[model samples]
Target: MRAVVQRVLNAGVTVDGECVGKIGRGYLVLLGVGHGDTRAEADKLWGKLRGLRINEDENGKTNLALADVDGEVLVVSQFTLFADCRHGRRPSFTDAGAPDVANELYEYFLTLVRQDVEHVAHGIFGADMKVDLVNDGPFTIVLDTDSL
Candidate 1:
């Protein structure tokens, strides 16, 4: 599992001209499930994400977690995070998890997130989505299960 976590002032996802999910003052999570990924990986990733302290404090220090600032969250399925581009000009997605399994883990991860977050939204899995956001401090973090 991999996730590109971006702190945003606001974020939303649209599908076919309809807004599917949206959030305010929090993280825009682009999640990818790769081959052999499991619930354990999701669990571990959530643990890290939930405790991430990137929000700022009164002293302008990035020391506040999501809960500390009453933040919302928008999650989107991003299978392309696993794209293998080391070979030729074209990127290969052979490393991404199968659709069925990937969706399952995606939902599972969402469930975990919703349990702790008051306002959590998500984009449709396997759908073409347009995401809009104003990045806060333009702070971004990339997390991979292999490195954790």
Candidate 2:
């Protein structure tokens, strides 16, 4: 499992011109599932993200976690993160999980996130969607469960 976490002032996802999910003042996470990812990996990454302290404190120090600021989350599935581009021009997605398994894990991840955060928004899994966001501080973080 991997995730590209970006702090955003606001974010929204649209599918076929219809808005499906939206959030304000929180994270816009683009998550990917690898062939070997399991519930344990999902749980670990979710916990780490929830506790990550990137938001600024009253003194202007980056010391507040998402919970501390009572922020929301926008989770989006993105299997392309597992794309292998080291070889030829065309990237290979052999490391990405099958759609059936990936969708199950993606839903599980969102459920886990909702448990800790006040609000959680999500993009349609396996759909052609458009995502837009006002990146707060332009702060972004990448997390890979395999690294842990």
Candidate 3:
């Protein structure tokens, strides 16, 4: 599993001109599930993200975790994170998990996140979504379960 985590002042997801999920003062997470990803991988990444101390403290130091600030989360499924572009001009998504399995894991990941943050929101699993966000501090982080 891979996730691109971005701190945002506010975020929302729209599908067919209808807003589905939204949040304020939180993280916008673009998550991808690989072919070999399992519940364990999802669990690990969720825990890591929840505890990640990227938010600033009262002294302006980046030392506060999402939990510490009572932040929300907006998770969006993005299989393109597994794209392999080393070859030709076109990128390949062979490493991405099948939709059936990927959707299941995606829901599982969301469940884990909601366990900690009640304000967790998510985009439609396989729908065409338009995401909007006001990135806070322009703080962005990429996390891959394989690296851990």
Per lDDT, the best of the predicted structures is 1
Going through the candidates in the order shown, the clash numbers are: 0, 0, 0
Off by over 4 Å in 2: none
Q: Report, for every candidate in turn, its global Cα lDDT versus the true structure.
A: 0.97, 0.96, 0.96
TM-score of 1: 0.99
Assess every candidate by TM-score: 0.99, 0.98, 0.98
Best by TM-score: 1
Q: Which ten-residue region of model 1 has the weakest summed lDDT?
A: 46-55
lDDT of 1 by residue, 55-74 (tens): 99999999999999999999
Which model, 1 or 3, shows the larger lDDT? 1
The sequence of per-residue lDDT tens digits that candidate 2 reaches over residues 1-148 is 9999999999999999999999999999999999989999999999899999999999988999999999999999999999999999999999999999999999999999989988899999999999999999889999999885
| Alpha-carbon lDDT of model 2 | 0.96
Per-residue CA lDDT of model 3 for 1-148, tens digit only, reads 9999999999999999999999999899999999989999999999899988999999999999998998999999999999999999999999999999999999999999988997999999999999999999999999999997
